[model samples]
Target: MPTIVVDVMPKAELLDPQGKAVAGALTRLGHEGFAAVRIGKRFELTVDAADEATLATVRQIAAEILSNSVIEDVVGIEVVE
Candidate 1:
């Protein structure tokens, strides 16, 4: 089986209030040295094939459904055997 991994993250120019809140909580909990935090999404899909055609389709799906291109980006894609 092949597993497709996709990571979606907010664009640098976009505001991530959730991320900021998490960062603030971390700081309140005494965690330090981190400059900032940005929340994102990851999807792990097990598929029959990890070929280029499948990847292309997945990319299109990501672009269309998984991310808001105006404020987010599909940051990573990988196929794991």
Candidate 2:
């Protein structure tokens, strides 16, 4: 079996309210030295097969249903086990 990692988040063009809120809280917490912060979502998946075809299908699933490409960006993906 192949394991997949999926991360999705708002694009640079859009506004990230959650991230902003966290950043504000950090400042109140006395954690300075930061200007901007962005938040994103992460998903871990286990695939039946570890092949290019299967991976492509997974990618499609991510693009169509898993994540909204228009307002999000995939920061990274890692296959574990």
Q: Mind sharing the TM-score for model 1?
A: 0.93
Q: Give lDDT: candidate 2, residue 44.
A: 82
Stretches of model 1 off by over 4 angstroms after superposition? none
- True-structure lDDT of candidate 1: 0.93
Candidate-wise lDDT, in order: 0.93, 0.84
> lDDT score of model 2?
0.84
In the range 1-81, model 2's lDDT, one tens digit per residue, is 778988888898898999999999999999989898999888888888767887787788778788888898776666778
lDDT top scorer: 1
* Local lDDT at 19 for model 2: 92
Model 1 residue 38 distance off true place after TM-score fit, in angstroms: 0.7
**What's the TM for model 2?**
0.86
Cα RMSD for candidate 2?
1.4
